[model samples]
Target: MKILKLEKGKLDLFASVVQQFGEVHAPTEHEGKFSFKRLNSWSEARLDYNRTVLPPRKYFLPPRETLFKYREATGYVPATEDLEKRVVLFGVHACDIHALNILDEVFGKGYLDPYYLTRRKNITIIGIDCTPDEHCFCRSMRADFAETGFDLFLKDIGDHYLTFVGTARGDDMVIATGPLFSEVTHSDIVEYKRRSSQKCDTFKLDLEIRDLPEIFELEYQADIWEELGEKCLSCGNCSMVCPTCYCYDVADEVKLGSHDGDRVRLWDSCLFATHALVAGGENFRKTRSSRIKFRFYHKQRGFVAEYGRPSCVGCGRCIEACPVGINIVGVINRLRGVEHASTD
Candidate 1:
């Protein structure tokens, strides 16, 4: 990995220089909360943001994207992003980067999703190390403070920030930018690991993720799901704000007078009553309890079985977004307790 340093008070310069390549996106104030937005000026970017309202996944898999456009007389023409316009996602947190890696497995697997693939091909990610957030549990999930998924990884040192270039694209950017960085000595690497290790305190939540999948298995019949369902409003805020939740529904829309129209895919939540209903009118997960259980299992259990890791990066967006304040960490802890009880 090529290492570089951005001197003190020049943090904004990172974004300014990256902008020269193409569009720059960083955490910026939107209304009242922080969101990843297009940056005209590097100063508009906020690096110390606790968390973004929506994860950076929107840059790859958008909420509402048009796949193709058509006319009644003509067949259809597929739409694609301008691959020439490069986008640099600056200030991405590690958990969000981990979420992107999980999405890569989902979208970039056997059946490549052209829409997500096109975006992935065009954009570059610059991830910032999380100092820690009160609600974040990234440490428990082992979403490293630094990751390989980033083109460049930045760690905030008091005077100068240390940057690691993980890919050829990242190395080229460092070379083109002409940012002066001293060669990283072995001692500096050791110090970086020490400081980053201290950042684990930020994720103070207690979650033994190694035992998560097995705990979930034992708690399938536990009464905690029913208890949570009562408090849950089924508002779908949890799924809506989730970084890795990729479930969607496809539908065709047509003008009132014409039978011709286009097919569209929109975000759908499992919490919805009809999410599992069949044409014959039999719904597999009929009750709110079952749906709630499914969501928890999908993230904590089923996904691990399928993907070899827990789907949650433990960003705790669901805890913050939930109207009833159903904390996922709390749910997992309760399940762990249930498992301990069964073993007794």
Candidate 2:
């Protein structure tokens, strides 16, 4: 990896230069919340934002997408629209980047998904460091800093961004900018380390994930599930906002009069009432308690068995999105028998 620095004043110019690579999308403020959207100009990019409403995962695995178009004559044709569109996702946080890496393991392995892999290849990720909010427990989830899964990563150090180039594409971006980036000095490294230490102290949320899978298994039938299910609305908001949640439902939509139709893949949540429904109206998880428990178990325990890590990145999107204020950190602490688990 190549290390460089970009003056704070040149950030706008750098943003402009990167547009040559692809359509630049960055975090932008809307009212009080933030989201990753196409930036009309560098001024629209909110690099200082804490967290976006949705993670950068949407750029790869969209909320809904057309899988294939079926017709009587041509049979089934793969949907190729926007599959090769080049996109640059800027100001991505470390946890979100880690989430994408986890998704790579899911969609990029076993039954490979061409649509997701194609988008992952075409899109460039530029990660940025963030101040951990009260809800953020990414540090506990081992996602506070990304070791890979990004083109470029920027760390704030006073007047300049300590940039780390992670790939050839990221190096190309640095090269295209001419003298905008400079060699990192000894003082720059010192500042980065000092700020990194300072950032660690600022995190208000902490979780111990070691042996969490075993703990979850032991508490499979704990009363906490029933308590959470009562409060949970079964709205599937958590899964929708989660960066690593990859559950999807596919359906063939036939035209009203013709045989021509399209197969669509839409995001699905295990928390939904119909998620476990099968033929003859037999639902494996009929109760809300079971549905919600399945979600926690799959992410914390089942995923660990398969992927060697929990699917939850601890980005705190689920914490903020839940209307009833169901906090993941609190839930985990309660399961561990911690007295007065931190909810805020």
lDDT of each: 0.80, 0.92
Candidate 2: tens digits of C-alpha lDDT, residues 148-173: 99999999999999999999999999
Q: How many clashes does each candidate structure show, in the order listed?
A: 0, 0
Q: Residue 194 of model 1: what lDDT?
A: 80
Tens-digit per-residue lDDT, 1-344, candidate 1: 67877665766655666776668889998776899999877778888888888899888877776676666888786766463458999889989989999999999998898888878877899988666655788888877564567888887765666888988888877777674555666766677778876876555675788877887787789999999878887788888888899998877777678766766667888988888998899999888888988999999899999999988988878888888778888778777763322111
Worst 10 residues of 1 by lDDT: 335-344
Top-scoring candidate (TM-score): 2
Give candidate 2's error at residue 68 in angstroms. 0.9
Model 1 pairs in collision: none
Provide the global lDDT of candidate 2 against the true structure.
Answer: 0.92
Give the Cα error of residue 180 in candidate 1, in Å.
Answer: 3.7
TM-score: model 1 vs. ground truth: 0.92
